[model samples]
Structures are given as C-alpha cells and as structure tokens.
Target chain A: MRINRRRYLTQKVAKILIWMAALSTMGVMALIVLQVLSEGIPVLSPRFFLESPRSMGREGGIFSTIIGTIALTVVAIVVATPLGVGTAIFLGEYTREGRISRVIRFGIGCLAGVPSIIFGLFGFVFFVIYLNMGWSILSGGLALAAMILPTIICTAEEALKAIPYSFREVSYSLGGTKWETVTRAILPNAMPGIFTGIILGVCRSIEETAVVILTAGSSLIIPTSLFSPVRTMSVHFYILAREGISMEMAYGTGAALILLVLFVNIVANWRLNRYIRKRA
Target chain B: MSAIPSSPLKAEVKKLNFYYNLVQALNDVNLPIAEKRITALIGPSGCGKTTYLRCFNRMHDLYPGNRYEGEIILYPDQLNIISPKVDPIEVRMRISMVFQKPNPFPKTVFENVAYGLRVRGEARRNLLEEKVEKALKQAALWEEVKDRIHDLAFNLSGGQQQRLCIARALATNPEILLFDEPTSALDPTATSKIEELIMQLKKEVTIIIVTHNMQQAARVSDYTAFMYLGEIIEFDKTDKVFTHPSIRLTEEYITGRFG
Candidate 1:
C-alpha cells in the first residue's frame, strides 16, 4: 500500500500530538513530586515525627497520627480482605453468567466509581450519627474498608479468572474436591493478584482524608480503643494546613505522605509485575 | 504388547449421552474397552472425543450442567458413574487424565510426581520417594530430572512438563489413564516420545486416548474408534480402522478425504 503525502503528513502530526499528550502528563507528575520534596525536606526533623501536636511554631511530633493511621489501616485490611476475596471467589468460581452476578458486579462498579467525598458523607451521617460511633477508629476503618472493597473485589476477581482451567482440572483429576482445588491451586495461583488489590487498598486507605476527618476525628493523642477519637496522617496534613501552622511544616507532611504513597506503588507494581512474569 | 490377560476385565459404556446445555456432545455411545488395551478415539474438533474420554474418570461432572446419561461401568455392577449419589472423587482416583496441554503445578519437580500419592495419605517418606522415582522412570524422565528434582516444574520444557504430568498420573496407581490429545501441543520429536511412552504404558494400564493426529493413533493404539459429529462411526483393531474401515465417514476421516 502506498501512502498519500497529505495523509502521511496528517498521520505524522497526530502521532506527534499523542506523544506530546503522554509526555506532558508524566512531566506534570514528575514536577509535582520534585516540588513537594525540595520544599518540604528542609522542615523534616526527628522531632517532627516524635513529638505530640501543639500550637503554631512550637515543636510537635506525629506519633499519635502515625499510630492512628496504622491502626485504622490494619483494621480496614482485616475487614476488607476476606469479604472482598470471598465475594471475588463467588463471582469468579461459583456464580455463572447470571442476573444476580451481573447486578452485584454493577453494584461493585458503581461503588468503585463513587467519589471519596460521598463515602465520607455516608460515613459521617451513618456511622457517626445513626450508628452513634462518633469519631471512632472502628467507624473510620469500616468506612475505609467499604470505600476500598469494590477495588479489592474486582482486582481479585480478575486475578482468579486469569488462572487456567487446567489447574483446576489437574487438582480435580487428582481426586480433590472443588473446595480443595480452590483453596489449594486456585487461591495460590491467584495470590499475586489478590496481593496487588490489597496493596492498592492500603495505599488508598492511608491517603484518605475526607473519610477519616468525619469518622476518625482529629484528636492529637493516640486512640485508646476502637471507639476512641483518632487522627490519621492525611487528616493531620489537612489540619496542619488549615490551623495556621507554618507552610514548611504542612509541605513537609505532604511530602512524607507522597513518599509513603510512592513506596506503596513501587512495591505493589513490582509484585504485580513479578506475578505476571511468573504466570507467563 | 503384553498379552491381553486370558480373561481380562472390560470397561463398558451403555447407551451413554452427554449434553452441554442444549447441545449434544456425545450421543448413544456404546463400547467395551478391553483391559490393558490402548483405545484411541479419533475425531475432528468438537466431535466429543475429549468429552467421551473425560467420562472414564468423571472429570466432566465437575463442570455444572455438563450432564452425562447412562452407565459407564468400570468393572460392572459399579452402578452408573454419573449417579449423583456417587462421589466423582472416588471415580477419579481409579481413572486419571492427562490434558492436551502440559499443565505442571507451580511446584518442584519431585513434588509434581508425588502429589497424587501424598493426597492419598501415603505418608511413608521412603515409599513416597520410591514411588516418585519409579513414576518418573516409567515416564522416561527420571534420568534427566533426578538431580534437579527440586527445580520448579515451570522451568522444564513443554515435553518434560507433559512427561511430568504422566508421572503424576502414574503415581495415583489408576486402573485406567486417559489422554486428551496428550501430544497435540508438543513438537514432532516430543510427540514421538509421548507416543512411545503411551505404547509402553498400555502394557501396565488400560488407556483411552483422544487424538486428532491420525499418525499418532496409528502408531500408539491397539483399538481405534472413529467418531463423526456426535456418533461413533467405527470401532475395531487399529489396522482395520485405518486400512479397511466399515463406514465411509471413518475411512474418509482416516484417509484425510474430509473431517
């Protein structure tokens, strides 16, 4: 086939435009990361992480914030992983193409697409007021778990679906029951996919501010129990910015949050890549 | 080649039918598989060869709504193999299948062959080791893989993986072994090796193989059953089926006139 001069020129221009669009997106992300680190690194001191929250210009640490973030995230993962994975298993294995599965899938898709602000509002009204677990880690963690559940379920379902049927057949050919095949070959083979979802869930939970603000409360001290007041790193960053704290301190906390997010992405992407390679 | 026992046990299927939803995969299939004979089911794609082969071990029953009607008597008086009250697991223990594509679990080579035995609660370490070695040797892979038994099964070549699967099946001590196009995914050299192994294996256990490869069927099988659409067109000694077939469809399929 021969290319016309006009068509060739148009194609060349289109390709250049596409490349420019891709490169510009990457460039923006790089600039933001660099800007945050450069401006915030100067304010990052050991005392910033060790001391308790206090008034403007005074030394304070994020120990309570860090502990609360960890506590809430752990609880969220504990609640979400099983429910999400079990739902995925049912969708992928037990449920054939049917109306109920389709409806459930639609519900999950909608949940995933729902904005973070909406989840926060729901948590604030339902868990905080209706359920009367106001500003509690339990409420915050449950809300975060609900927020990330769809993501976990969908990713896990895809992973399970990717496993070859022959693996199940081999297990069954060895006289293993359906449950045995799932727990043994199916789950093990799909572990990397499940792990990827978990990593994404953890990353989202750690960065979530709106949901934590409403359900977890902004108390500076560490929470004594699940029902006690709590504050996470993201909420802390927001409070630091709005409470007339130094811009340097707010930027520093922002940079730390960015690093944690970056670290989670790197680890999750590496694991996902390794899993794909092993399967290949 | 091992002389068919003076009075060998027979595997019988009586007016069996298989349906996948509205479509019939197998229709009114009736045959007796002589003990220790290599019976090859030769047909084109979607002709129910694999479907019929899966019935020997009740492998198809696991998939929902893939129903089988009628009796598949492994030794007679065993009741219908597809009966809901009967556990397919027990049926599988006596009849194992090797798939078209070699599928080795993501485990060490030694563990691959020892899986079936271990699942049966045969826990004696020495016995397990002996069985693994014996099964691998029987599959013609022991000498090559003995030193690297700890290596991951995925690291092996496709042919080695297929042989490993064969070894795994052998470890189960099944009365019958089913192969659904065992060499269809292998290269010519690998295909020949598997053919040779099948020829050897038939001496120890009854085998029902489904293959599109007429040459392989000619080379490995003792009895050949030619199927078309959803019916068995012809079943006879391999030589008769290939050289002097009873039905025109069987002759045409074997002679490459048409599928």
Candidate 2:
C-alpha cells in the first residue's frame, strides 16, 4: 500500500511535536538537577547531616529538623490513611452515583484544589490555636492530614473502581457479604494504588514549609514529645534562606530534600511494579 | 450426600415473573428442577434462559431496579427464595453459580477455593485444607493444580480458571449449582471435561445449566426446558425434547430451522 504524501507529512510533523514536548520536560528536570547539585554539594557534609542546629543554624547540623520532618509526616500518614481509605470505599463502593456521593466527590475535588497557604492558615487557627496544641507536631500532622485527604481518597477510589464488577459478583455468589468481599478481594487488589496515593502525600509533606512553620514551631531544639515545638527540614531551610542566616545550610537542606524525593520516587515505583507483577 | 433423588422436584417455580425496570425479561416461568439431576435450559441469545437461571439463586438482587414476582419453593425446607422475608444471602449460600467467562479472584488457587469456607467462618487450617482438596477433586482440577495450589489463580489457563471458579463454588457445599452458559468460552476439549464434570456433580448437588449447545443438553441433562421470548415453549425429558418435542418452536429450534 502506498502512503498519502500529504497525510504522511502531517503525521511526521505531529510526531516531531510530541518528541519536542517530551524532551522539554526531560530538559527542565535535568537543568534543575544540575542547578541544585552545583549549589548544594559543597555545603552537604557529615556534620550537616548529624549534629543539631547551633547559633541559629549557622554553626551546627540539622539532625533535629530531619527527625521532626519524619515524625510529622509519619503522624500525618497514620491519621490520614484509614480516614482516606474508608472515605474512598464508602464513596466508590457502598454509595455510587447518588446525590450524597456526588456532593462528597465535589467537596473532595474542591479540597484538592485549595492553595497550600490557606491550609497553613487553617492549621494555625483550627489545630494550633483552637485545639490548644501550641504549635506542636500533633497540630501540624492533623493539618497535613486534612490537606492530603482528598488526594488519598481520589486515588483509592480510582483503584477500587478499576476492579471488574465480575469479581464482586463471584464473591457474592460464593456467599460472601459486602464487608467480606471488600476486605478479602477489593482491598488486597487495590493496595498498590492506595500506596501510590500515600507516597504522593508523603512527598507533599516532605516538601511543605508553610503549614509546618505555622503549626509546628521552628525550634532548634530536638523534640522530646508530640507536645514539644520542633522544626521540619523544609521549614528550617525556608527560615535560613528567608532570614539570610545561612545560604550554605539552606543549599544543604535543599540537597537533602532532593535526595529524599529521589528516594521516595524510586521506592514507590519499585513497590508498585512488584505488586502489579504479583497480581498479574 | 443423598445418592437417590428423594423427590422429582428439587425446586418448584410458580408464577415466576422477572422484570428489569419496566421491561419484563421473564414471563410466567414455571418449571420443576429435578433433585440430584441436571436440568438444562436451552434457548437462543436473549431468550430468557440465562435470566431464568439467575433467578434460581436471586443473582438479579445484586443490581437495583430488578423486580421478581414469583415463588421458588425449595423442597423439604419449602423456603420461598424470592420472598421479601427470606434473605438473598442465605439463598445464594445454598445455591451458587458459575459464570460464562472464568472469573477467579486475584488470589492463590488454594485461597480461591478456601474463600467460600472462610467466608462462613471456617478458620481451622486442617478443615480448610480438607474441604479445598475435596472441592478441587470434585471439579477434576486437583491433579493439574495440586502442586501449584499456592500459585495465583490468574496464572492458570482459561479452562483451568473456569474449573477453579467451579471449585470455589463447590467448596461451599451448595445444595444446588447453577451454570450459566459455563462452556460458552471453552474449547471442545475443555467443554467435554466440564460437561462430564457436571454430570458427575449431579450426584452431590442438583444442577441447572443454561446452554446454547443442543448436543451438550442432550448429553448431560436429564430434562430440558426450551424457552423463547421469556417463556417456556417446551419442557420434557432430554430424549423426548430432542427426538419428539411437543411444541413446533422447540422442534424448529432443535432442528436448527431458526432461533
């Protein structure tokens, strides 16, 4: 068969455009990686990763900030996962295509679109002040949970919906109840998708500065309890850079942040692939 | 296990009428499914054979807006399966179904077979193992899958997956089994295996099969019901239905004159 010259030329142009679009994204990522490496590599040292901040983050390391970052993220995820997964199941399975479900879905969509700064204000007022938690990790975690709930719920619901209706029919015909079918078949199948949502939420928590600064105080001291005020890595990096206290420390924190992101992406992709392979 | 069929009628259908919203799918379906025997419902596509088969276990209850006006009275218990008072879950437990396409759960073979028992609160490892093995054997898939029972159900071929589904249904020890065009997707070899298994399975449980293949019904079924446009046109012994049908429509259908 002979190809039409005009159509072939059009197809060639479209292919080139697609290639250009894809390369542009890759080029931007490479540029950012190069810029961060040049600025951050010099300041990143053993002491920067080990010792507590001293003299307003100019003299010592950011070990306390690292611990605080992980602690708050862990708390956020622990609280959010169950709430998000339950909400997803309720929305996707029990009550699909109805007035209440539509309203809940709309609410979730709105929540996801809200700006990070507004979430910070909400955490500061509702969690820190109103709840009297006094700028602690608990308050920050609670706020972060609320912020990431929409992402988790949406992804989890998508996962649940992806499962074929035939599976559910088989379960029912086997004398399984709704709860039994969900726990045994639906949840296990949807775990990888749910984990992807959690990984994204974790990534968000890691990079977040405003919410942490407002709800979790930027203290140099390492936190002893959930009540104690502490600074996350993002907030510490933000404060150092904003106050012109230490550019070196800020770059080092940025480098660490980049590495954490790389680690998370690698792990998430690996875990997801493993699960998909197992399912197949 | 009752080797001898105590009564001719295992389940008596009286004034069975089914509707999908305003559209009536089955109209006044009345038939007696024999005890410990295979009763095949044969008809063309959209002839209400599959729809009538679904009503046996109340499979239509899964979706909303599906209405049933009937009494499917199970013998001995005499429970009206379609009644508002009786739970559909309990009815399904006593009567399980195997679908057209193989739909094995995304779990191990053992887990898939053990699921029915586990759902009923059978947690003891020995009991589950015993029942799972028994069901697999009954489905004639034990030798093929015994060594690899721990493997995922999807790892099996299409026919094996269908057998696994059958094993899963059989594991629950349902008194009645409904096979809805079960061999429609199978190759001749797999189809023959399943047909033989169905005949053997009738000794343990009453079997109601819906098939388009006239030869399959003739081979396996004790009785045959020919349906057309949501109504039974003929119901008689398999030999009589194939050799000398009472209705012209049934004779035309059986002789390949037209659907």
Most accurate candidate by TM-score? 2
* Alpha-carbon deviation at A273 in model 2, angstroms: 3.0
Per-residue CA lDDT of model 2 for A38-73, tens digit only, reads: 798888889889999999999788899999999899
Which sections of candidate 1 miss by over 4 Å? A1-3, A56-58, A129-132, A268-280, B1-7, B118-127
lDDT of 1 by residue, B1-259 (tens): 1223233555877888988977898999887788888889998888889889888878877667788888888774555677767799988888888999999998789877887887777789899999999999999999889898988899899999999999999987888899989998899999999999999998888999999999989999888888878788788888878888878788888888887
- Chain B TM-score for all candidates, comma-separated: 0.95, 0.96
**Alpha-carbon error at A185 in model 2, in Å?**
1.2
- Please give me the DockQ of candidate 1 compared with the native complex: 0.57
Q: What is the DockQ of each candidate?
A: 0.57, 0.80
Cand. 1 Cα-lDDT: 0.86
Cα lDDT tens digits, model 2, B157-214, are 8889999999999999998999999999999999999999999999999999999999
lDDT of each: 0.86, 0.90
Off by over 4 Å in 2: A1-3, B1-7
Q: What is the total number of backbone clashes in candidate 2?
A: 0
lDDT of 1 by residue, A201-240 (tens): 9999999998889888888777899998888888888877
